[model samples]
Target: MDMLPVDRTNAECWQLGTDQITVLTTCAQTSGQIFAVEIRMPPGGGPPVLHRHDPSEVYYVLEGEFTFYVGGEGGVTRHRAGVGDVVPLDGGTPHTVRNESDADAVAFAVHTPGAVMEGFTRAAAVLGAPGARPTMEEVLALADAHGIEMLGPVPAQL
Candidate 1:
């Protein structure tokens, strides 16, 4: 990697349904130290499915509101976060993020030790090529192959 900045023009991007993720920094660029992505989440829906992975993640909300449900040893907790709010999720914690608002939301997600989320996104992008939307089962298989486990959608009551 050069000692220069990486903008969207030079970055990889992927679309997951209504959400778009732009890979700002890659594991190859950071030597597996870290990876980051900017996510644009549409209103009324975020990632309805809950998931857990080994790489820890931190999300900094840049716009709009979000509802997060996190599950750990202490049980599940719901968080209502908005612009400027930072949500840190430890490795292996099951979590789901949602946008119950009327407008889109933007957030930055950072993954420690790199390659994890980006790797999944790279493969997932293929599954979505030419707008071929893969089923949840297919996505789960891909996620499982990359050390991620999808724990189904968030409970409706939450």
Candidate 2:
């Protein structure tokens, strides 16, 4: 299959929850090899729940700082990552990330063998619109459809 070059400058950005998500490379674009997205999160913003999915995710911090929570048999581990840091989340590992700094955060997230994340992100962008708070049930249903399992709420402290 021929893979065309992607110019993100023309990519559309969608508000997925509190973050701006720009799908840089979609599954269709890469023939299911990868899915890449750029996310811009406001201070104190992040995903609402810790979740696990089929695709391994790698995050490269571009600006500001973020706190990541990874769950394991020993419980959850918290770590701080700043610009230029690379954080990898293995497939089936439950984890979440947040921007706890005073400034906004920018990061690039890449999923290997790109599952349905691009579609999931697009759906989330619409369901989580301003003044439209999606219920936990709604969120879980969406996640389930994308082969993701919602674990629990994000950690209280960064």
Which candidate leads the pack in TM-score?
1
Look at candidate 2 and give me any clashing residue pairs.
none
- Candidate 2's C-alpha runs over 4 A off are 1-5, 155-158
Q: Put down candidate 2 lDDT per residue, 14-113, tens digits, no spaces.
A: 8877788888888877788888998899998998678888889999999999889999997888899999999999899999999989999999999987
lDDT of 2: 0.86
Please give, for residues 35-151, the per-residue lDDT of candidate 1 as tens digits. Answer: 899988888767767889999989999999888999977767789889999999999999988888889999998999778887888898788776596887897889999999888
Supply the TM-score for candidate 1: 0.91
For this target, which candidate reaches the highest lDDT against the unseen true structure?
2
Cα lDDT computed for each candidate against the true fold: 0.85, 0.86
Model 2 worst lDDT window (10 residues): 1-10
